[model samples]
Target: MSKTNAARILDRLKLPYEILEYAVDPDDLAAESTAEKLGLPPEQVFKTLVARGDRHGVCLAVIPGSAQLDLKALAVLAGDRKTDTVPLKDVQPLTGYVRGGVTALGTKKAYPVYVDELMLTFETVAVSAGKRGLMLWLAPQAYLTATQGIVGAIARSSPP
Candidate 1:
């Protein structure tokens, strides 16, 4: 398969990573499904979210697929009083990546990235490869370096 922008960046940086591809179910864009496909735990798979802060124009937040972003807490971390996810229609235009395939590592816009502190619990985490059906797996530190990500308690367990 051809390299995605994210893969290219990782290669250029000489950061080791594994690329995993699975069948895409357009109807099911959830990250958890992808994790299952890769034989990884849901918590090890992260999904990227784009949010607009009252003060910051836009930024990317990544959290475990099984959890949901804590917008109020993220606002505090972002130094903004409030923050909301960007509209679905605008996600592609804003980040050059459609839903189910957004990665902050190599986006159209270089927005600041914040990864959930929980990610550090694992030796490696998996994120989108900037394409549907593909995932990038690498050490958390390497991911932080590649995406310039800040680690914090940005997510909490989502209700079942």
Candidate 2:
């Protein structure tokens, strides 16, 4: 398989990860759908989100696809008064990654990366490979180390 920017970075770090690929549905880019395509639980498939804090600049939020980011919680963790998702139009320009393909590993900007504390609960978690239709699965610690991610309660379960 061809390497993505994220894959090359991982290789440089010597981080061992498994790459998984699935069919893409341009009309349905939801993380839940991606999880289903891979036959994995929604919680195991993480989604990368970019947000800007009032006090801080832009940052990346890696949360479970099954969960929703808590702006208030994120703001507290970011040491800011508030946090808001970056506009869809700005995602690619800001992070060098488009929606559904943003990963903390490789970005246009090295914005602070904050991962959901819940991620550590799992033995392995999946994240975008900085491209659509691809995901990287590795030990939680490996991911944290790769991105120098801050672990905190930055996410809350979505309502049923």
Candidate 3:
């Protein structure tokens, strides 16, 4: 079901993408860990985060595995007073994809999407393929076009 959704999205966009599957230990499901397990650079891997803002409504943020989402920056970008992570329990139903499988593209709802500027450093980036153990490698522009996402610096340096 997950791979099907991702394939459908790719077909619709007419974009070329490569799907990479790897073994994922349920207990270690995190972007950085996943990247390490896949032998990919952390900066080339992105994590989809669901956040709600006071005025901009619910939005999706895609940031590097090594960076943190800058709530204040996101709020400013969304023209809102504040931003908060959406509850995990509500994420699946809200995005139509399970927790670790959430992708900015092909979501159940069409919400505003913001991509961290860091992703631009890579010619191709990896993101979840609507399922755990599966990832898609594609050009960053394809994601923006597919999701109608806005690109900006909504990421902060990882806590030291």
TM-score against truth, every candidate:
0.98, 0.98, 0.95
Query: What Cα-based lDDT does every candidate model obtain?
Result: 0.93, 0.92, 0.87
User: Compared with the true structure, what per-residue lDDT tens digits does model 2 show for residues 37-138?
Assistant: 999999999999999999898999999999999999999999999999988999999988888889998898799999999899999988999889999989
The sequence of per-residue lDDT tens digits that candidate 1 reaches over residues 125-156 is 89999999889999999899999898889999
Better of 1 and 3 by TM-score: 1
Q: After superposition, how far is residue 115 of candidate 1 from its true place, in Å?
A: 0.5
Model 1 Cα shift for residue 95 (angstroms): 0.2
Runs of candidate 2 exceeding 4 Å displacement: none
Q: What is candidate 3's lDDT per residue for 1-160, written digit by digit as tens?
A: 2455876888887988888888888888889898998899888999999999999788999999988999998888888899998999989888998888899878898889988988888899999888898998889888778777788899987887
Steric clash count of candidate 1: 0
Off by over 4 Å in 1: none
The local distance difference test score of model 3 is 0.87
